[model samples]
Target chain A: MSNHDTHEHGDPIAEIKKVTIILSVLTIIELILGFWMIGVTSEGGRLAIKGTIVILMLAKAFYIVAYFMHLKHELKNLIMTIVVPLALFIWFITAFLSDGNSFRNLRNTYDPHFKEQATIKVEAKEGHHGEEGAHATEAKEAAPATEAKEAAPAKAAETEKK
Target chain B: MSNVTTASTKEAKWWNGGKSPFDVEYGKVMMWYFLMSDAFTFGAFLIAYGTVRFSTNGWPNPNEVFKSYPFAGEGTNAPLVFVSIMTFILIVSSVTMVLAVHAGKMMDKKGVVRNMILTIIGGIAFLSCQAWEWNHLHHEGAWWGMNPFINADGTASSTNFTNFFFTITGFHGFHVFSGVVINIIMLIMTLTNQFEKRGHYLMIEKAGLYWHFVDLVWVFVFTCFYLL
Candidate 1:
């Protein structure tokens, strides 16, 4: 194939260095956005930052595929062959996520126990969160939580039957 | 004579039989398609994760879950620090892989060996970091169907968070392990002058493609699980 001959003219090393810089810069931007996101508790602000992160993510993906994977040097038809099929992801993500949201709505409307569980906040222990030292006490505390969880569902079932 | 010329030109077209329309070799084409299928596999996993997260009312804040790194004191409040390091390692390895591919193109065996070794080291380091993170989380009572951390809002959380975390990262770690093995084998072949004898280094190119694909997947996983 002429594929080997096609890319023989360019300075491949220089191209690699350039793309490396681009990828790194993009990742740093993404991390900065991520760290900034952790401190922001506002809903709209978080959404906007998340949207920016996703955009940067896609840009990173493009660099990796187009440069690192050498897809840009390939023929037009070859690029199409790969890119066209990926369009399916748009539909796939939309359908799955929307369905998941719908399922949550349905559960909230129909299942009183499921709705109640989310509203009830667990009391935070004074310290020792998720540490080995806290395991004993955690187990002790979880026992009643489990019993209460089970009791809530049974009560919901009884109410439904009535 | 006109009929003969028309027939000859028709056969010479790019899409005509006896030549690749994409101008690349059959192996590279197959590799691309294989990576495409693998992409779908990972896509299915992350999408499934999204579905579960959407259906659930509360998710454990990832900042609370993945805060500690190696050598950090207990109860350190550093979130995304460890993961960003992991992300950088993978990206640097990917850059090394690209360099190796370029070296292979030049038929510079020493350059190929050097870059491949660096790539392999990077892979192993990334895998080790993953192992530490997994072990640490397990110590915190996180596992399949078990979650110690409550939701971001303090409500009792579902087990799906840890479930997806372990399963997806485990699968990605497996890919990194296999990529490291492939790179080791490539390194050996380069050292042994296998590509020199073959008069081409197409094999390294293919392995580099796989390695870069692994890095590409991590970008998504990091975003979906840690950042978002």
Candidate 2:
């Protein structure tokens, strides 16, 4: 190939390397931020840390897609073909997440009475031994270790049979 | 073959010195379209995961749940350090893949082969790390069930959340494994001078696109699953 053809080909490999280095540095920063965020107590500080990490991740993603995937060099129509579908999909995600989140909120606030009744039934099923009753009640208040353990074995057996 | 006919049509159009509609090589154009379709599949899976996660009132903190190693009893002390190392390994492999593509462009066969070997090794390491992660997750008492949130009564608040997490990540891991296999094949082909007669290193470039896509998807996975 002539020097002109060489130049026309453009050293995408070199560009890819440059982007790779940037992504590496950003990933290290993400790791540090992730560790640091785990130590933060304040909600605002946590949010800031999360927002920064998410932004950095998106930046890394953009670099890989644009450079490695050669989207930057592609025709405008091709780019739109790839991007528009992604935008539409994000809309679906948003709608589903909003509905799901609302359902969870309703369950947490408005359905506690039904949940308590369910817990009572579970306690009854476990024979309601004095210590076990206390544990079950505590599990209802905190994490439900006993119920998970009991349910887990039964599920495992069923799955094994399947 | 149909492909030959299509190639002939493409050549006839470009043979007359007319601009190709896509402004990209046919192989490259096809790869983009394939990737776009794949992206939609991945997007659907992720959206499903988000729906399930949102439906759960008390999702288990991923940092806590994924922290335990083989022997370490579950506790706050374990901090998912293994995944961090896996992430670093994958990033390094991506860098080596770029270097391989660089060597291919420069027509340095030795450099290409060396870097491809290194890239393949990095890929294997990544696979091993993923295997370890999978084993850890699937072990009994490790709660392979897909409940992102632990209910107050200690049962999974929603099994759907955990199921989606595992299925999506597992599918992505399978893709990585296949990519590594392809990289290995390309590496062997290069060592044997398969591309020497072709007079071009487009295969390396294509593989680089694929390897980079795996890395890109992982970046999103890391954000949505681990960081979020």
Candidate 3:
């Protein structure tokens, strides 16, 4: 049979090669920009560098899905089957980030001093007798704040020197 | 009696061939379904990663942590250049895979073999590059501002973010390694004239799909883990 007869079967290989070249060139350009902008001083410069990298990454992803995955040739229903799930997945990521951030904020509000005091008390009463243990526990409870207060002058002196 | 049987066989053959609804092969359709499932699996991992990153306070800046290589040690300020190279290598391999697929379509088995070999090499090279990046990250000491649980010495203690970094990227790297083996097997099959007899290079085309998937995952990882 002539090649024309076989053409209906789809020529994936030809499409793959064209897409690959485009992806490779784009990747190389991304690498170059990543290197050249290594010492970007300004915040704008930093954002610019970040933006370029993200854009290149997306471009690479687009080529792979479009060509390698055969989404380019698939029927509309099949393409939607792939794309819709992907959008929902991104939404989940956003939600996860928000929840995680909120939890972190709540954790930050608890007093670190209380945790430090509790830790010291747990350590100091390791092996003492009943009365000694109680005294040691009380002392441990009070010690961190006193120590913290005492250390303030030293910290102040250090700051003055700086 | 023989004439009667022959007439019945002819009628059945015409009916079966005239209006077949499904023209595509079962294996090809199945591969597409499998790919869709795999994409969801990866999406779940990425979303989990985002959750962890969000929950943590003072997440390390990707640009600061992943500065370019070669001069990375000089200022400790360069962005993730090595990872970017790894990304580039993968993209290049995807290209080679496409070229191989093209050669397969033309029935130039020699070209297919050469391009497949090139693609395999690219994959191996990318994996090696990733290994080096991981080693560097592991040896770097933990940062001070990281999650502090305090130690016996009254000093602030921290956990290694490197561990999480390695886990996510390492898992993806293993996938790439598997893809390489798959490519090698497909290459061997192509060389034996297996595809030639079938009059199609569907096996190579499927391999291209897999290789491209690897590239796609890395793109997201590179952004979320290295470029963010």
Candidate 4:
């Protein structure tokens, strides 16, 4: 007679109110941590911050899926039926991400666009090299380089199509 | 008939005509299966996003990308405060949905009607927030980066971050929008006394399952697109 599985008995309203407060507070903690991580500027420290954010996020995901989705009250078999396949999704994303890294490296090696980017850097450096402290000449030099940068991508596309 | 064996009665129960291995309501079990399939679709979109983001080093910072508020600081990037409010709205709506289901259980018709209305309002509010976000992002040329063919940032705009941003969030937003429509239908049915005729409010519970699914999916979308 009692839907005890969902805690829908004996002050059920109070139970849900408590859950709401908890979820809201957790979200606040997440936002604060995110901004705090911003203040730490070391590259290695940044990676640590990213990992912590991910961990906090997974905790939020757990509460949402468990209490909100009511999966926490479902029978063990049904819960496993959903959770097992979701685990595979993590593996799936990792595999694809590795493949993406390979493609990025390959593009840098093969795409002529990389060459154009390099040319801009070289020109910018040369302009800075001469004490010709004339800001106007540097601006003029930067204009042609950027124009070439735009034209360069179109040429790469043509070669790619060929 | 009085002398019938207990074994015979057990064998003759109505389940003899059908199977329920999980020993739960048929409708609820079916809803679980449906949610699993839907989860797979969301997972695939997010996985594609991960692949693209990983491949391109030129992906824009999420904080800088999503930091604009509606009217204030239209030119500045103060990251995540607006979407955080959006998250709160959806969660509050989810709370109202649960309360509606609770009312249905107690056969409190007025309670059900009031809570359903509140839940529907919450859903509409979330959808309105999304429409505003989409309009703002469009004006800011975010969609231009989403176009795979358009390299707006010289060479770093590789259609990686922007493409997934629109596709994943847009998909979640569509689900929230539909949840609102379904809630409105449930509200109308409650007003018409349909649940009274049925003698139970399992329909509301089913819809609650669906609305919760929408909220759950948003948690992941918020993490993937905004927080992390």
| Top lDDT model | 1
Report, for all candidates in order, the number of backbone clashes.
Answer: 0, 6, 9, 0
Query: For model 2, how does the per-residue alpha-carbon lDDT over B54-117 read when each residue is reduced to its tens digit?
Result: 7664454666556655455544346657677778888888888878876787788998899888
Candidate 1 Cα errors over 4 Å, as ranges: A1-9, A125-162, B1-12
Top-TM-score structure, candidate number: 1
**Candidate 4, residue B97: how far the Cα is off, in Å:** 1.1
Would you list the rank order by TM-score, best first?
1, 4, 2, 3
What is the DockQ for all candidates, taken in turn? 0.39, 0.30, 0.20, 0.25
Model 3: CAPRI class: incorrect
Worst 10 residues of 3 chain B by lDDT: B141-150
Each candidate's interface RMSD, rounded to one decimal? 6.7, 8.2, 14.3, 9.4
Question: What are the chain A TM-scores of the candidates, in order?
Answer: 0.75, 0.64, 0.53, 0.60
| Tens-place lDDT digits, model 1, residues A127-152 | 33342112324444655443322433
What CAPRI grade goes to candidate 4? acceptable
Writing each residue's lDDT as its tens digit, candidate 1 over B1-228 gives 333333433244667656577767788999999999999999999999999999998888988888999998876889899999999999999999998888888888999999999999999999999999998887666777666677888787767898899999999999999999999999999999999998888999999999999999999999999999
For model 4, the stretches where C-alpha displacement exceeds 4 angstroms are: A1-11, A105-162, B1-19, B144-155
> Candidate order by lDDT, highest to lowest?
1, 4, 2, 3
* Native contacts recovered by model 2: 0.38
- Candidate 2: clashing pairs of residues: A144-B153, A144-B154, B59-B149, B60-B148, B146-B162, B146-B163
Better of 1 and 3 by TM-score: 1
